[model samples]
Target chain A: MGTKRTLEVELSTTGLSPDGKPQRVPLVVGGDGGAVALEAPPAMEPEFEGEHMLINIGPQHPATHGVLRLVLELDGETVVRCIPHVGYLHCGFEKIGEYRQYNQIVPWTDREDYLNSIGNNCAFALGAERIFGIEITERCKVLRVIAMELSRIASHLVWLGTTCIDIGAFTPFLWSFQERENIYNLLEGWVGARLTTSATRVGGMAADIPDKWLEGLQGFIRTFPKTIDECERMLTKNAIWVGRTVGLGVMSPVEAVNYGLSGPMVRASGVAYDVRKDFPYLDYETYDFDVPVGSAGDVYDRFLVRVEEMRQSIRILDQAVKRLPDGPVNVDDVRIILPPKSKATSEMESMIHHFKNVMEGPRPPAGECYVAVESPKGEKGYYMVSDGTSKPSRWRIRPPSFVNLSAIPKMVEGHLLSDVIAINASIDIVMGEIDR
Target chain B: MSPSFTIVHPGTGSNATPVTPKNVPVSGGPVSPTAEAVGAQFPGVISRTVVSRGETTIIVDGARVHDVILWLHDDAQQSYDYLSDVTAVEHRDLSLPLEVVWHLRSLRYRRFIRVKVLIAKGAPLEVPSVMDIYKGADWLERECYDMFGVKFAGHPDLRRILMWEQYKEGFPLRKDFPLRGRFSRSEQLKNALAANPEARYSMEELSIADAFEELPLDMRRRLSEGEKVGE
Candidate 1:
């Protein structure tokens, strides 16, 4: 009889199990019925002194999206465990808001999530309004939806474009920026600022949508889907794209909910819960766009969810433009909303209100309200507390980037080191918000 | 009397803070069983519950905080599945000097609540970690500790998050700390550069660039040779 022979096989699910769950049965052998140990073959990385080699990536690495740091423990090519170190971008946003007045804090909120500046402004405005019990006009509601949806499109375009480049495809970025520049032009036309538009105000907006911006939006909408098609043509069925991303960074539905993922993150995990439909703030219920949910919560599914989201955002913009209401954007109430330049020059009270409003800021009634909006990244909420003072006692922002980035270690563990880039990009973190 | 008068408290006058009614029934009711389950299951954990603006604010006993959070999570039908945000407030003006607040949301019940714990005067800035129950709370607890100098017992790794690893002096977010930081961050950066000469960072990807606007206190303050950092 031949000496009992032993053969080595790489049990894809053998030594390393995805999702960091312990593999109870490690003795999965090949055709030779010889019992095996949990150890890998010589080809695999040798465990020296019972330790894995550690490598640190980014407080400045380009692929990290922003100044995120990762201390990854590796067994050769496969990552045994991933430890994420954030706070490289912390700015004390919550602490700073305590000193600034209610309306004065809008610009700071814009800096929190730079991509979705308008959405951040809108969420803060909604929370501030509720705390002050201010009811905005119908036109104001329509305009907010328009601005937010446009932001959603622009933000998603950046994500779709940058993430493709992150996964090694370069052409999609230029095509992606084309549509984004058009949207930014519209934002510039409406709110004088583009990337950091403190577009919306507490009671209403800064100004009515300037002159012919709506016509520009209509032009963008008619031509935007072709860009989406351009992206899909480049990546959707491409073997290189699918092979690298599909079935990677899988987060099950239960895990996704427990992780507190919202927006595209939770949607990719098949959770149909959207702040717009579930909570229904800012006349979001009135808009006719469907929430795009995915079955498998992998990187590919996340990509699909975001692409589909851009389409849905277009639908929302289309509806909003058709149903655009014409009225005074800001409330006529001089207390919360600033008086017009015409009124300020003519009347002493208006002038006094303007000066006080600019200097001292709107002293909202002392109470607390947590307003959550469906920002492109996730559910961005601002929890404001007023001690009946002009400045807020606590201005806490619930940034989705911070929360969503927390789930990365679980997603990236047991995968190859190269997959870290794919997984990180798929999550779409903006460290500005995470650090804030 | 007008409905508007009823809404805004008369005492606040023209700058009336929006009032969502002084209080509503939250600690007890036939409505949502979250408060009921918490009260029945974990006695003495939840002390006071204030319902305002159609939202609930629960004042929890700090001692049994971990148990309270665990019970709130594992329970069926009324699980506060989402740990929305964890932060601290310096209520220096109020009798209680420091208060930590937790915002929790339940997808099942589709309701949200704000839970608070007042750190007793002279008590060490420490709170039990809720990391085991909600993994997402890991960074949040660290952030609270970093900004407010609050400590989380049983935290896997708790250190200065936004600030540098060797940073001393005091917490920046505390009201006592000056807007321009006590230490000269530029001098500190120079020392860091001298110490770790190989530490190269792109300004765009670097956190220190933002740290300037953040740590712009007393730009004139020079580092004393006697003053030590990471001793």
Candidate 2:
């Protein structure tokens, strides 16, 4: 009877049968009861062979933008793993802060993010204000906002110029620099120095904005956005530019958040995390501006976000100029900020105040505070730990470039080696801030 | 009225009650709950609690640094996820060679805390590494290691960051290290050559090249003749 056997099939839910239920069920073959053979699943194997290659891109390469070296593990041209080797330009700014007085450290902050010197100054001054527990005057706040916004425009111009040059667009560099030169001229008129102003003091500013300087700033604010538009018109719709940047180095919002990305990087990823809005300091709440955000977290989004941010800065600058009050720029608190040079020379009381302020310094109460500001690169924060002394017991900076640069590996991994340069330019990292 | 006034005592030994104001409040109005909580948890760990200028600081024992840091990071109440920086101050004359400081911040709480570890002068002075918890601490720890020579146990790579390649055997940031150039002219030249092989030409050859490059035809002949006379 053809062995007269019944084929069995297993039916299991919990990998076991209930009492009285058979472990295997009977199956019938075609026209007769019979056993059937089943085929086993195939073994799996790796599709590709060979080890990933390690490539050192830069400590001294043109695309790095600074003295940045990236150690990349490549599977052919595609990057597998990337490790950024920082400290090639370590300045030890925090350690230097310990030796210098509160006001003396302002110039050092300028050097931290040289492109956004005014923003750095604002962050440091805001931190000092928090520690000193002094309220800034209305005029001082407006002045600071105006200065910082102008500096933001300048910083974005540099980024655009350098970034364009990186992508082989050379004309924009000269065009962007021309406008930046105007902003620098205005800044120089007010602060006496172009790059490292050291203009903002703990309580307020070193000097009031000169009338001519204010006129120049107002004139520049009106014209800056038109220039930005011209820049955008040149590159925004260009097929080649879009092709190079649009879909490259795409990072999700969740990945950006987890990686501690901030500023344009986070904004480009559709996250509305702005220090100005979230933790408002130095009267940033009063400013009328929009925080530009993008859907796709790509190099192009980052570029667009920065470009839009420059327009927003110009808007803030215009508002700041309009609302700028005419009065004492600094607070009456002589203990925290310095007295005017004229007052010091003329009045005996002012001389005594100056002497006391200089001799004793601003004795911040024993406490720690972290004050962050929206720097052109990202959230530039100063973490000051006071010990009721003239000098901060511990001075730490949350440099945006440093934190944003950390996301390099995530951005560059799985991208081609050639695309790495474009990604680096998009981030706009300054090695001074990174290594500090 | 006279500038100076004399006072007479009723009793033979002058037992007078101190004149005090009734309206004055005492003890700076109930210490900050956060500061008190930190103090209570540590239990004799803190040497002093300072509350002035709206800032609160608790000085913790240096020996119990790792324990304190672990508590700060792990404890739900104090989740200091980010290590802002690690810096050190050198006091050569004091008993401790270095006072290592760790600044930590909690993004969730928007609070900051400082932990200091004092290390005496000597080799093998070790501080527990926080790189295991916060990866950001790696560079900061390396920086501390490089500047202060304070060893951080389990640091991936602790090496000098800012100083020159041949800046061996001395921590330049320390108060003791000379600020000015330490090497002689010949030593500087040798070090420069060692650092960059491309700059292999000697000063004499460089001078000759500069003379030929900068001088006019007539001036070059005169300079060569002068050099020959000097030789």
Best by TM-score: 1
Give a tens-digit lDDT track for model 2, residues B190-213. Answer: 865554422122232334334444
lDDT of 1 at B216: 22
- Estimate, for each residue in A1-436, the C-alpha lDDT of model 2 and write its tens digit: 0001112222211123567654533222232222322221111232587555556677888789788877676676777677666666766677678767788889899898888888789879988877766778889888888888888889889999999988888777998999999988988898899998899888899888887777888788888878888887668755446656755676666566545567898788776667676546666766778888877677877898999999898888888888888899888887776777999999998899899888777787656666668888877778776766888855778777776776787777667787788999999888888777
After superposition, which runs of candidate 1 have C-alpha atoms over 4 Å from their true positions? A1-51, B1-33, B92-94, B184-231
Tens digits of per-residue lDDT for model 1, A1-436: 0011122232322245687876633333333223222111122345664435556688788899988888776777777667676776667777788888877789998998898888788788888887877778878888888888888888898898888888898888999998899999898998999899998787998888878888998999999999999888767755457666756677777788777777888888877767787667877767778887877677877898999999999999899899988888887778788898998999999999999888878877666777788899998888777888888887888888888988998988777788889999999899999888
- Which residue pairs in candidate 2 collide? none
Per-candidate DockQ versus the true complex? Answer: 0.14, 0.06
Candidate 2's C-alpha runs over 4 A off are A1-56, A71-75, A80-83, A250-255, A333-369, A385-394, B1-128, B150-231
Instruction: List per-prediction Cα lDDT, in the order shown.
Output: 0.75, 0.69
Model 2's alpha-carbon lDDT is 0.69
* Model 2 TM-score (2 dp): 0.71
Share of true Cα-Cα contacts across chains kept by each model:
0.21, 0.07
Q: In model 1, which residue pairs have backbone atoms overlapping below 3 Å? A: A365-B17, A365-B18, A366-B17, B180-B217, B181-B217
